[model samples]
Target: MKRALVLFNQALRWHDNLLLSEHAYFDQLIAVVVLDPAEYLTEQYGIKRASAQRLQAQLKLLLDWQQQWQQKQLVLHLRIGDTTSCLLQLAQQYQAQSLIAAEPTAPEQYQQLKSTGLALRLYDINSLLQHQLRPDLASLPKSFSAFRKQREPELLVQRPLQLKFSGQFYGETKLALDTVSADFISRYHTPTAALLNEAAALERLTKFIWQQRAVLHYKQSRDALDGDWNSSLWCFYLANGSLSPCYAWQQVVDFEQQQMANESTYWIRFELLWREYFRWQMRQHNSAWFSKNAFRPPLDFSAPIPDKRFELWCKGQTGLPLVDANIQMLLHTGWMSNRGRQNVASYLIFELQQDWRLGAAFFEQHLLDYDCASNWCNWAYIAGVGNSGARQFNLIKQALTHDPHGDFVRHWLPEKTTAGALVHWPEAKVQLQDFWLPFLKQLKSKA
Candidate 1:
């Protein structure tokens, strides 16, 4: 039998998966998902590589995919252990001839997959632009503007593959979920109203563009600190591969043609391009992307041994109201706005003068939409280590501009009842002085 083993990496869904198309030729296909334990272990920075919330979210996606495959009479075997070892065992057990999977963006995972001496077929289904069309790694642009200028002319989002498998299926293996501790799940599980699946992803795209007509104002409101419609909220789906960027791109194109073509509609594409830039950048830098300096020279910098400042920052006890509020929001909900992320990241890297990687690690732990490239590259960019060096935000200016009325801060920090602009400056209110004075004085001394 011409059997193939299909591994679902980042591209979790079945709709646009190129790997599933191999079923047409293969006599029997084994679908598998391997969850590496290394992903859940705490790193040297004292942060889990993947947080409980993110793990839980990923598990939900896998479970949903399992049901979808069952409907088509295919089994998605869930395995937990070393990915390479699991794949080899399964391949040998099933007597598979070839291994198929989506191209992983993370350097470690990418290298691991390549080291497996199997007849492999990998496809780049996660990105908006196809892999072959991208610039050579050696010649890849260092800045987003240059990248955009180069690729915009030839910009083409290929149609997602439509694969329907009706061939013979491989039987099930032992489910690994039974091995997962209930304590781990319960610890990280915060009930969310959002559905993390392909069907829900499609429904969201339709509702955001067609039903609410919100994409029309996306450009103007994308920077807002908080709101349901301010942003497209597509990042959650895009990060996990529930929604293909090509599918999203086509939806926006249809919206522009049928309704109205404006800056708001175009800005959505612009943001997607930024995401594309980071993905390619990660591929170019490889292991260096995760380094402390991140493709840049290390500076003479050392944080305090105990790193009390970082602890305060993580807990939302920092004197800066805007930063603290955003941190609190992220801790509670596993999400924050783009504007909030930039501002808080700036505070962590510049204001506190802590290691930028720690801030990135914190985000990786808490952010529901955390993509490895996007998270680490962005931290490096803000810290002057990545492309387009050192973009710092004036915390007070940012708060005044984005949250002029301090409604966002007050919403998150109910104790900060100081009306109007006073909420942004905790030092102004007598009640907050005890906590604010010491931090403010230390900052001034450092300056």
Candidate 2:
């Protein structure tokens, strides 16, 4: 009997139903994902204990996804230690034929997977286009505009419907979802009985963005910090493979054929390319993608010179209204908007002068849609240190320019000004310089 196990890691996603729908074809499918033992350890030591708590919370989110999916009594496996060793052991014990997964981005981890001697089958489950879709992502382009131009023509766009297994190896699964342990899901996740798969992801997209020609307005409003429908909620699903990127692009194509194309519709494609550029950065650089100095000078993840100040930044109490509100929302809900994301990231790397890696690590620890390549590559991109692009946002300039009226700043930062009288208040460069002198010092040291 060629029996195999499907590994489940609640690192950022739960077991994917789109993938699991193919489960019926395998003789025996035992799904598994192991939480690395090192997850309990502090990441960079500056925010050690706080990070450990966030890791636990992320695991809890995954557990919720697993419980919701394991209704069929699917052979779900959960262990908190070495994943490769566990997979190999189970594969040997079952004589499984192949292991199927959406390939991971971490070079060292992927190498470990390559050496495992299993017939590893990687599908285009995450990306709308492959990393090399654009000829030049493989070669570092000098500018974002150039990178975007090179990619637009060559987008290998396609949409494959979610997989549904045919044929029957009608055997019962051994594992049950109840055995999994985690509490954050029960405490906070929004309750819904909808089909929790790629189909559902599509349905949500239609209702939110595609149905009403709303995506036609996306290019203009995507940077709007507070629009609920500002951006596609695709990351969390794409990160988990509950929804595939090809399918997402197809929905756009269908919408464009029926409606006149606009920058908003085109912008969606642009962002998808921007997302792939990061993936290619990983392919071109390999291990160096994880290194801090791949683009600019090395980041200073050493220590927070003013430790209390860093805590204040983390807790959303920096006296900066827009930045504070976004941070608080993330701490409460494991989600944030695209504009909100840029605002907070800008605050960290620019205003706080904190190490960009530290900020990326913090995003990985908390973002429900955490993709290693996207998060770190993005951090590098924004910090003038990744890929070939050298762009960095000025947090104050962004705040005043975008949130001029401070609706975004006050939404989660009501304490700064109870009535938002200063919502459009101009930020003082002196305050920014004084608060972030340590960070500028580090950057200057490298210069």
Candidate 3:
């Protein structure tokens, strides 16, 4: 009897899952998810690695999977502590023949699993295409545009696997719900948080692509700060692997074939490609991406020692109306719009004059849909310390363009609203007009 232990992070759903779909291959299989101790520890910025929202989402996801597998008489083990140690301990206890799991994108994570020296097999469950890019780090493209331009014409998105756990399997373990700390739950509960599960994820995708037909106007409204029709909100699912990118892509292709084929339809796929680009870049750059001096020639930079100002920004109290509003939204609901993210991140990096890594760590700690490559790379880009060119937002112009009516801002910043004023352009809280505008103008001119 050859048994296998499945260790997965990121790829958590069963529909398009690599290990769960192929359970028949093993005589017996035990699945496990370790709540790494690192997730609970505080970083230099005084924020824990995982917020209550993220922890709650994870708990829900695991519970959902456990209920599904329980009907089949299988058990999913949920443990806490170091990732590598947990997997090995379980493997030895089960006397498993090998480890089966989805490949990890972050280099440290990938290396951690590989270093176990146990027979391990990993799958690229995160990617849409069946054929992965060759493992040639040095030969990879230098930029995202080049990668997309060269690959989009030839990329093939595979159909999702239709799985059936028909074979006889292990059925002896007890099922139980692990206790999530009361303090954690009490501190992070928000009435507006989205439910985390495969059913909810699929429903969101269906609504966005077909029922609401929001894809038709995604190109135009994607930057809007509020409203469901503005964006798909699929990142939460994609980041956690409850939704499959390939399945989403196939749906878009089907939509175009049956409905109308336009830039909006193609735009969704373009965004997916950007995600793929980051994954590939992570593979190429390895762990170096996390280093402050990862860039070639190293960016000439300095950040003020994190102080009260930095702390205020995190609490959404910096008092710049637009930035404060976005941060407040994120704090209240574990989510924020793309435009909001860009604006707030830019303010943290340039306006607050704080360290970019600190901001990245804060997001890593708080964001429910956080992805290593995307989150860190974006911070590096905005901080002018990435391989890709820097992006600096003109906050004044951006607020005027996206929230001109003040509906988005007012919803999050009611105090900023003036009863008769046409727009809620609140005065800047800090006195920086003397140099802020000219510095931004110079940066824009250079770009």
Candidate 4:
């Protein structure tokens, strides 16, 4: 009898998963996700690889999947420890011919999979138009615009495959919720529990496309720091494997046909292209993508580190109203709007003058929708040390534009009830020129 062992790296859902689809060809199939202790350990940035909020969200998703597989008379095994060894042991016990999984974007995950001494069949579960636009990784344009220009014409979001499984599989093991931290799920306020499963992802997809019809005004309101209708908010599921990008695109297409298609509708697809770009960047660069100087001009290695300032920024006590508010929201909910992310990331890299990687690490730890490629590459972009030129946001200007009435600030910081324009902005501790001047001088001299 043929048996298969599939590892749930990032693609955690059964729907639209290529690895799970192969279940039909195997007699007995076992699905497992290993909670490697190494991931929970602290990194060089002095932050845990994941925060309580992220851990809690993941745990809830696993639990839901466990109950789901259990009802189908199959076990969704949750193992803990060295991932490679765990999977190998499971393979030996199950007598599986080969291990299989969706390819992982993060360097660490790719490394772990390589370490596993098994015949592996990995599928690209992340991208949508892989077959249509298979650009050589080495030849991927450094600029997103260039990449988009070439691929946009051929952008074809494939229909998500509907796999038919026997609904019969071997193995039985209860989920080990205690293996992950309990702090993430307890006592903290989150957006909603609906964010943790494929069913919820589909629910959100319907609401965004039908009930709210929010795509009609996405471009106009995407900049708003708050509100549900302003953005699709699908990244939460996209970051996790519960929702496939193709599925999201399919829904977008349906929305366009059912409703009026406009620039707003196209903008959603534009954002997806950006996501794809980052994934390609990671695939090309691998672990090197996380280095301090990955794709841009080298930084002056003599600069002093700002540990205390970075800490303040991370804790949302930086005394900058807009930055603090965004950080506070992320700390509480493990989420922040894309606009909020750009502003805060700029503040940390340029204003506070902290290492960009440190900021990336913090986001990786906290954000519920964190994608390793997007998180790190965006940080590198804002720091002007990676793809494209340096881009810095004037915090005051951003507040005036996006949160003019300071409503977003007040919403998070209730203590600032008597808010005037940027009232929550404390007196500046570090003047803009302190960092800005050196950056300008370097760029000017280079020019």
Candidates sorted by lDDT, descending order?
A: 1, 4, 3, 2
For residues 192-253, write the lDDT of model 1, one tens digit per residue.
Answer: 52457888888889999999989999999999988888888888888888888888998899
Best candidate, lDDT: 1
Please provide TM-scores, in order, for all candidate models, with all chains considered together: 0.89, 0.77, 0.88, 0.89
The lDDT per prediction is 0.78, 0.60, 0.73, 0.76
Clashing pairs in 3: none
Which residue pairs in model 2 clash with each other? Answer: 5-30, 6-30, 6-31, 6-32, 7-32, 8-32, 8-33, 322-409
**Any runs in candidate 1 off by more than 4 Å, and if so which?**
23-25, 164-168, 173-194, 297-306, 428-447
Model 4: lDDT to the true structure = 0.76
Off by over 4 Å in 3: 23-26, 132-135, 164-171, 175-194, 295-304, 419-428, 434-447
Q: What is the lDDT, from 0 to 100, of the residue 28 in candidate 4?
A: 74
Query: Per-residue lDDT tens digits of candidate 4, residues 285-377?
Result: 777666677643353333235588888898888877788899999988888999999999988887777888888888988888888888989
Off by over 4 Å in 2: 1-4, 8-30, 33-42, 46-80, 108-112, 130-143, 161-172, 175-200, 295-308, 388-392, 418-447
Any idea what lDDT model 3 has?
0.73
Model 2 residue 183 CA deviation (Å) reads 11
